[model samples]
Target: MGNFDIKDFKGVIPAVLTVFDKNENIDEVGMRQLISYLIEKGVDGLYLTGSTGEGFIMDSEERKRVVEIVIDEASGRVPIVVHVGAIGTKISIDLAKHAEAVGADGISSVPPFYWKFNENQIVKYYEDIANSCNLPMIVYNVPLAGLLGMNVIKRLASIDNVKGIKYTGMSHYEITQIKDEIGKDFLVYSGCDEMAMSGLLAGADGIIGSFYNIMPELFINIYNAISEKDIEKAQRLQRQAVEIILYSLKVPSFYAGMKAVLRWRGINAGYCRRPFENLTEEEEKEFKEGYKRIKETYKITGVEFLDEL
Candidate 1:
């Protein structure tokens, strides 16, 4: 893929989950299969090394390996936007350089968290990474990442190397305001799964959802339909997608449900790392029942999500 423009990232792009083996190591085979599955399902790109991918918890070596594995598997078929956000500036720069070296299509970084920083410091932190890498940078602004506001985002987006932003916060109005003030070329993506369509309506370029790892086709279809101005079809698919996620929410284990769903399809994206629990046998059973019920109820057919089965 040659130089992926921010506009080209205007469909569903999942922040894919990182698979770890029992030894707490990257499951290379599982990751490859996961990337293949997503591509086959018609995802526009992969948001590698995000919160869902356990990026913050991973060391620089692990982050580099994940990026390399994803780029190798992508094979220029789909764009891979690597997330190089780390708590430390040096490590984040190291990851960005690695992403550039590995032929990543783009790079994104979350604001430094756990320690409060003034606006100038945040700007410098991002500018440092954006300058270090050749890839266009996407500013990831997740509310859970210590509450940086849109004013800071506008300033950061104005940086020459900053191409776009992944706005994962709950503030739709702020996202709209950012889009309005920043002008075009500043692509903004929704970070939340449930608000995927809502964000699109509010001027988001696309979505970067963890839920897309489990349901790429449906989300991508809904996104495409919405973009084409087919609200009827988009709304129909969005309802079905949300219905399934509701089960994950009700089960009190969304990530666990994701792993179980992946395992059921034999992709082996593996269980999440420690402190993030996997599904029990009973939970898996319930999730399977929920999945089947959703498919049967919606009468879905010939979709990429179903092709995995």
Candidate 2:
């Protein structure tokens, strides 16, 4: 905690999609390309090895390797927060220590799930990992791992290095409550994609979402619009994003649909690994057509240049 300010974690960070090859191995070159692309498009930071990065599916070594590759390529251009949440407490600690060793700016983790862990057990789990490294902790309330209650959230936030949270649920009132009841300096990032405008208005310091990997500019526009007090403009852009997200949800998997969109955007973001469906030939075609409908249907803005599909 020497000079680390949790405020650096704010703004439009992508839950960054992990790039993989046809065989679903980590593709280092593709990963570097995607990092540069997002940074060039004005992303504030990168959250690696979370759901979008497919960390839960990868083994410990694989997760550590992904963090290493991203840190080396990013070269400190933006703050990198690695997700260290895993099924085992010791494994999460190991990953957290590795992230600290490789110079990641911060560490985050979803709560351990798949079984019952009492409140104290949960608190100790986070406490152990937070004490493992000097890097600040961003508690990820990403329900894929498990849900974190408000009482547990406050307890965790009270930890020495625990500074913020990635609130993936869709409740702004809760965001407000976290700030008002917890420290006002506490950083809470809205993890839900569709609620960008509302979340910001509700006092979310920043936004981190899976969809940001593909349409970062649109979300950035929403952030700027909020800053400029242009509610009308922000609402319009948020609607466009919601449109895209809803359409992506219709695909075999929203994450896979995002990869397809990334390829369409000229980035070679590969498919999600096994157990997650990659788009079929027919699905890909339908995804493209639905994308075209979005473009025609809305006065969309802030997306970088793209060729017609």
- On lDDT, the candidate that comes out on top is 2
Model 1 misplaced regions, further than 4 Å: 1-3, 292-309
Q: What is the lDDT for 244 in model 1?
A: 70
lDDT of 2 by residue, 49-165 (tens): 998888889999999888888888888788899999987989999998898888888999988888888889889999999999889999988666677889999999889999999
Compose the digit string of candidate 1's lDDT tens values, residues 178-270. 878988668888888887887888889889999899878778887888889998888777777777777678665576668777887778888
The lDDT, on a scale of 0 to 1, for candidate 1 is 0.82
User: Which stretches of candidate 2 lie above 4 Å from their native place?
Assistant: 1-4, 305-308
Q: For this target, which candidate reaches the highest TM-score against the unseen true structure?
A: 2
lDDT of 1 at 14: 93
Worst 10 residues of 1 by lDDT: 300-309
